[model samples]
Target: SQTIHQWPATLVQPVGSPLSLECTVEGTSNPNLYWYRQAAGRGLQLLFYSVGIGQISSEVPQNLSASRPQDRQFILSSKKLLLSDSGFYLCAWSGSGNTIYFGEGSWLTVV
Candidate 1:
């Protein structure tokens, strides 16, 4: 049984402050991990993806970064926050197919 866990169910921060969101996969090997954001009434947007540890691909240029320090661990961070960054964040993983599994997700509202 595989599972994904994302932390900080919700967050509220001021602009220019730091932010960190974490996600981890369990019971899977060499899984493809991804980070995505969804705006209100909008479709999900891919932020980052990792094929393996230390390998990250950014889908868009923004104030966020993703890192894979361990095989099952993925971290998303921002040195400074922006009001435009407010949205719903999701961490997911896929296992060689179209079936993508996601975590509980995190909501960010920057003021």
Candidate 2:
């Protein structure tokens, strides 16, 4: 395995709507999972990360939050959406080195 899975591959929401993104990694143990966002023409920006179960770190101050409900699962959620929050969201995981794997990604467009 060593694969990453994410849901709601694409989304279109009105401003002020709520959003949730889920991800899971398989075939690995205690992997470092990350949540990232990419804008129209910008690079990936780290939003949150987790080293282990119940260990989450936020890199930016925004409406986004993350959780590790299980050892292999990571979640990203927002209670209220903003136009600026629309972007390409990605879930990734890494082992003990520089190698990292990313999910198929979720694209969000706010109207």
Clashes of each: 0, 0
lDDT per residue for candidate 1 within 1-111, as digits (tens), equals: 999999999999999999999999999999999999999988899999999999999999999999999999999999999999999999999998769999999999999
State the lDDT of candidate 2 residue by residue for 33-70, as single tens digits: 99999998889999999999999999999998999989
What Cα-based lDDT does every candidate model obtain?
0.96, 0.93
What is the Å distance of residue 55 in model 1 from its true position? 0.3
- How many clashing residue pairs are found in candidate 1? 0
- Which predicted model would earn the best TM-score? 1
- All candidates' TM-scores? 0.97, 0.96
Over all chains combined, what TM-score does candidate 2 have? Answer: 0.96
